[model samples]
Target: MKKFTVLVLVVIMTLGVAGSAFAVETLDTNDMQQREERQSKASNRFEAMKEFNDEHDQIRVLRIERNHLQIERMEKAGVIYDLLIIAWDNNETEKLRAAREIRKENIEINREIRALHEQVRTARKEFKENVKAGDFATAQIHVDEVIKLLGEINRHNNIKVTNLDEIISVLQ
Candidate 1:
């Protein structure tokens, strides 16, 4: 009985050790390296966003941080997603230079959006003042300018959206 029990224990131990060794052999270092690279890239993106001359810069940074946290919570694998990332890492970079170009475009549009917002805001204030002062003709002109400025804002927003879509295509 003792001999049989010892043989059974040795067989179990040997099988467990062999199985674990196989698992270790199959594991790769790419996952850790990819995670670190992604962290650094996100930090770079956040810094670039903070350079914007707008009140929304903080909000942009916070949104990035929030998303980063969310991504961290998810399973970030390497080889499984490598087929897609490998292609993206190579060829798709030229389209938008790996998000850098698109990011620049978005920054420029954000500046334009800010300028348009200021114009529309002051125009609205002056429009109300003119109305109160019984300057109907001037108030009507301000209204027209406000409409034109708002249209410009919308156009810039569309450009930003397109830029974002381009980034998403290359990333995913």
Candidate 2:
């Protein structure tokens, strides 16, 4: 009788522990599902931000190219200005929001090129005017300024191209 009683007690204890373990397992599964959902949401947000950043960068490139053409035309006309309106326009609030967490220093540098461009335009215009007015000495001063500005811009453009090439190489 004692042996039978002990067997029953052992059986009861085993069943109790197993029941509690099952309950804990269910809770753990629920927690895992919740964690998965949160991770999915975070992943979606990251993907969306990356997509937006890429599109914004494309638009920036287009604008930069347009501004470059304008600069070329102005240079031919002996005009210079550091206008970065193209960069400003390409940089909408959405672009800023999406790009805040990404590597954006290169884009920023390209955008800032506009300011330098405007200064060059001003100097070029003065030089052209001096030349047309037959003020050789004044025109020569303006020419020197133009040369200096162009040199700076050329160096900057070379650096930009090299950086872009490096990035492309890494991507490839």
Candidate 3:
């Protein structure tokens, strides 16, 4: 009778241990599934942000190109102004005609610059709106892109614009 009771108790303890082990395994499986789901969702979010980042980068490039064009237009205007001054001082008919032609070109360049500026303004507004709506990660991406663009602009123009510095500061 004593041996038989000991055997029964051993079997009961074995069953209890097996039951707890199974429960732990089940919990681990559920935890792993949850983790995988979370990871998938995070990946989707990152992919969407990447697409937006690309679009924003393209817009930034367009803006930088427009800014460079504006600088070219300003330079042309300055040249025309100098020619006009020379024409007035020297009473030269050829210089005056050349100045008038440059003025016409300058007017056309000014119109194009204005249109480009409006487009840039629209892009900036959209970027600001996105940042304000709690898309800080994407905004940071845009900020980095703009910083790179500013560096390129400075290199091309050989001068740093204070307004660009202000913009970088605001983004930071």
Candidate 4:
């Protein structure tokens, strides 16, 4: 009976030691899991930040391209105006021919201008639609396009335009 009791006690002691060792390992495992969770969350945040940065860069590139196009349009407008002046300086008949050419060119330019205005109007309409849909990013993109078109129009005319009605009446 004495020997049996000592063997039982030894078994119990071994089991307790094993259990304590397992507990330590379990604690380490839990710590590792918590660290993994934190790392995953940080990775997700970094990915989101990268996506935002990429989108911002794309928008900046688009703005730069739009500005370059506006500058090109302004340069073309200046050339056309210079040609008109040169025609006038040559002679009256040449001036008349130049005026006719100017009128033709102006008509073409006016069409383009009106088309740009229509584009702006359409962009505004789209922006309103996007706003209603809660798509602020798309709305902002449309607004930027409208601003780009407006800049091009302003550079083409270089004149103060207060009232659309008066401008149309005068042009007519």
Candidate 5:
């Protein structure tokens, strides 16, 4: 009887151990599935964010190019204005042509600048919408892009202003 009781207790303990191990394995499998799902979601978000950033950068490049073109247009206008002034002072007949050309070019540049401003406005609106929708990762990317664009604009404007000042001084 003593031997039989001991055998029964040992079997019971082994079953208990096995049951607990099975439960733990089941829980671990479920946990692993949840973790994988989370990782997949995060990866998708990262990819989307990366794509948004790339597109934003491309737009910024185009904006910078447009700004450069605008600066060149302004410089050209300045030179032409100077020529017009000289022609007027010397009673030259080419003053009318220079004046008309400057006017036409200035009008075109103004239109281009207006269009670029509209593009920027649209971008900002979209950025705000993203932020409001809780896509902060994408919104933050847009903010960074804006900062970079602003920096470029500031640098360009500074140089243009200095050059304009020099030209004005020379003319005076």
Candidate 6:
């Protein structure tokens, strides 16, 4: 009986030591791989985020450049519109001086401009009134006359400009 008990105790002690050693080995090898994989995935995610942010910033820069170009174009259009208006006015002044034999820088240019402006204002006011009165025919006539006056005053007479109205429309 005593020998049998000693043998059983020794077997239990051996199994306990062997089982603890196996567990320690498994934890070291397997858990090291799991920890390393987790770190690798985290690094990959960080790299992907950085790439996405770089693309986003590039898009913002492109949008700013586009806005700058649009602003420059609009400003240029405004300047051209103003210059064309001045040229049209000068053409009218020249026509008056030559037709009426008015002295240059002496008089009549400003007065002529005022009279012509008044004509345009009267036409426009009549057009508006006719429209409000539902007289579309009269309104159309007045508007057509206004267009004729503009054409006469602002004609370039150059084949290079086949359509002057379109230029004014776009610039305006």
lDDT of 3: 0.59
List model 5 lDDT by residue over 27-120, tens digit each: 9999999999888777766765675676667657766775775687578557757865876687765545544553555456446545645655
| 85-110: candidate 3 lDDT, tens digit per residue | 66678777765664455445545644
Q: Rate the local accuracy (lDDT) of all candidates.
A: 0.64, 0.58, 0.59, 0.64, 0.65, 0.56
Q: Write the per-residue lDDT of candidate 2 for residues 1-172, one digit (tens) a residue.
A: 9999999999999999999999999999999999998887676556544534544464356547656855654453231112123324665454333333222554665676777678768987886566445465685566566556655665566555554444333322
Against the true structure, candidate 3 reaches a TM-score of: 0.36
Choose 3 or 4, whichever is better by lDDT: 4
lDDT of 1 by residue, 83-148 (tens): 346656676556436667667887887898799889989987997676655565686677667767
- Model 6 lowest lDDT segment of ten: 155-164
Q: What TM-score fits each model?
A: 0.45, 0.38, 0.36, 0.39, 0.41, 0.30
| lDDT at 9, model 3 | 100
Deviation from native of the Cα of residue 1 in model 5, angstroms: 79
lDDT tens digits by residue: candidate 4, 1-172 = 9999999999999999999999999999999999998887676556544544654465466557657765755665565466555555764464455445445655666778788889978987996676555566786687778778876766544321222222233222
Clashing pairs in 3: none
How badly does each model clash, as a count of residue pairs? 0, 9, 0, 0, 0, 0
Model 3: residues with Cα > 4 Å off, grouped in runs: 1-48, 112-172
Which wins on lDDT, candidate 2 or candidate 3? 3
Counting only residues 3 or more apart in sequence or on different chains, how many pairs clash (N, Cα, C under 3 Å) in candidate 1? 0
